[model samples]
Target: MPDRHVTRSGDDYAEALSQLLPQGQAWPRDEGSTLMRVVRGLSQIWGVVEASASKLLEVESDPRITLDLLPDWERNWGLPDPYYQEPLTIGDRQKALVQRMTIEGAQSREFFIGVAAQIGYTITITEYRPFMVGLDRCGDNRVYGDGTNLMYSDTFVRGWLPVYDPQGNPVALDEISEWPNYGLGPDTNRHYWTVHVGTSRLTWFRCGGGGGQTGVDPHLRIGLATDLECLLNRWKPAHTQIIFDYSGLTNGGSMAGTP
Candidate 1:
């Protein structure tokens, strides 16, 4: 026997179903037969039902594939976090959802490292403590004052999102990029932390930077910003300050499925 016809027109279904009648009804097989016409009409309704059922299973819950459902998903997930005052691109919205679903909160180094891995980053978190003479071991490298590293400015101009490199050089930063943190003022060094994400993704233009390709678009530069600062900031312990270190990127890395 063959597989039953699945999504056919009413006429096809009528023909198949009509055959289920006993052979004694064969005398009514003509087009004028009311019983045959009634079955055909009913099959039209069945055909509509078949068409609906056939397509329903193809629907998806994946945020990227279901663009229209993003608002619903985000709403239910309580997303578009208050930190994101600037409008997000389609790509960012997708990233936000993936981040939300994959993030599991904790204050440990392993927890943050795992969260960063899910969104195309490999990170190492460093916790800080104000250096105390007897409490800290020699060469433990703890700081006495702020121990502040030149990192991304938490204060962005006009509240736009900017990815900060916490371990960046002080010389490279302009006045606007400088974080107005108090130096030699407070003893809250224990609340500060840094994440070294292993190298910058930025590609600056230079005469010999390209591998002999000349026609490449200069404006189409790869950006270093991952918008990761916002995600980490929102989830980090309320008392801790975060610094993203991008000045020490290493070689030979792939971002896909990094966990």
Candidate 2:
């Protein structure tokens, strides 16, 4: 037998309901057909319910919260205001110094090395002034601490010189005043070792001229070695990364789900 097809419309549903009821009676008749009227009423009710649900979601997800709404004591409960937090500790200050120094490039390397020395650590020098080992006769004839003639007056100096005894054994120089031409030599062979003791004091050493002339040995100097080792142990450079989330909660409540 061939399959029979049925149309699916509001009238078809009404007719089907009518057939289910007693033969003489029909579904409650009304204007614009009972089925359409019921469907329209349900749609209107659903619209009101949907609007109410959307309003509830809006209330829950609201993100407007200000400190003025709460008492002073209550404001400290969650996230404390950055301005009102405790002052940074020494470690924090040191870390900040390292971060800033790293950004300043070569000029700040001495400062970094000083800090590392204090902490009992050392860093390899990748770049430095080529004529750092010589006198005031490199690229610019003017030398550091030579009044106002130097081009890069801000740069630090590190040089070495040898001391020779009139006899045979090497000996330290009695006084710096003995050498009038010290630091004024045009050749790289006449420089002397100088150790900086803190920012203000510099101690110059005139070693016995015997072995190959070289840079100052930081470890051999008692004062410099002790100070630098102390600093290295005190402020070892292990920096920690920090991240902050600026997105705050809604009216002091838990974070709300998406609407």
Candidate 3:
């Protein structure tokens, strides 16, 4: 067991006094005695220093539970960026701080996948490239910039968000809601890419879950991964166009996110 740092009390002092001297009859060590009263008074004063030292030594050390030193840490790291709006929770602040401190800067697809995992989503990235002749397979349905056989994610407005059930209760669906890969086009279109996430977030309601009826858990539904999309937009390269998509169907099939 860990040691208690409360320091010596009157009982401890009295016991030590008896041990240090020859077997004593005068030192009855009773609480009512004058000698015992003096010992108790001294223990209180001594306890103040011990308690202070104990608290000092225990100063919040881990960032996971770090409360007292959070402000100092945030200021030093130049955090609370405009990318994230206010009314943020302490857990959110801590996560951003730790991410800022440890994440490696990269523009790779795998890197973005790792970033999604940090925010509680498992996702896949699709990179587009301009089509070519001879080098490309015949009848491969490559884009010629005419818009045929090519699809792109225009997520200018995400209308598929499940903010309410059919009954209009405030709720989010629990589903895959993943989008299909935005087909590539012209050379400039190569900058357009897509991320397909595998899960959606939903808060448990007292009445049950997000399903409008039957009280079904909807564990296999494909909903939205809003946070993953937001974070990716904030970090994607200046030249790249990111398309966030999730399956609209519960069968794990892709949805045509474009108009």
Candidate 4:
């Protein structure tokens, strides 16, 4: 037997309609001409609409297109990617800075200070350092140095001792000189014997001068707690702000207040 074809085209629809007509009957050449034109026009219009809808659906389904899913503050506000161009205005730079800092969990001093206070430590903003960048650089051309000098300085915290053992009796300097320094180099030899007390320091910096201008340099530095546990325990959410309430959809009530 001949194989049966499952798919049909527009010609197949015409042939099937011909079979439905009476014997020797036929449609006029111009029959339903206006209706055909209307349908053809409608098909063309629908094609454009369908293509646009498909593009929108494609964008909506993509996980990387997250602007629509973000809150107003977190969204890009239709701005182009800041990394692609040098921010010319203060607002543009601020937006870029906030976006980056939010991602880094260093958005504000409050966040760092709050976390530090929780762990019996205090943060102090104490020093500033400035550096020069060439004119060809991009973005905020002038970047301030973080207060690493103070953080690494021995005078910042004094309770810590530079002895090998805090509880043991003090050893003579002559005795320490005779003892084997092991694998420690001369620069780190003194540090090898130090006992770290419950004191640490963190330094943070802000980018300060830009706008396509020359000779405009600014500087600022801030301190943060360097306690490993406190720093690690800081409030660093994956999202900078809340935009959705998933609980309302799944639990039949808003989860606005309850922790």
Estimate the TM-score of every prediction. Answer: 0.50, 0.16, 0.51, 0.22
Candidate 1 residue lDDT tens string, 181-206: 32333579779988877643333233
TM-score of 2: 0.16
> CA lDDT, every prediction?
0.56, 0.31, 0.52, 0.31
Off by over 4 Å in 3: 1-59, 85-89, 137-184, 202-227, 248-259
Point out the higher-scoring one by lDDT: 3 or 4: 3
* lDDT (tens digit, per residue) of candidate 2 on 172-203: 33311112133333443232222222221112
Better structure of 2 and 4 per TM-score: 4
Off by over 4 Å in 2: 1-180, 183-186, 190-193, 198-259
lDDT at residue 97 of model 1 (Cα atoms): 81
Evaluated at residue 208, the lDDT of candidate 4 is 30
* Model 4 C-alpha lDDT per residue in residues 1-259, reported as the tens digit of each score: 3323244344444444544545532333233655434444444654565555554455333323322332333343433332332222332333333433443456354664444444334332111112223312223322222323211212112333233212122333322211212231343233222111223322222233212123332222122222222233334333322111111122211111111
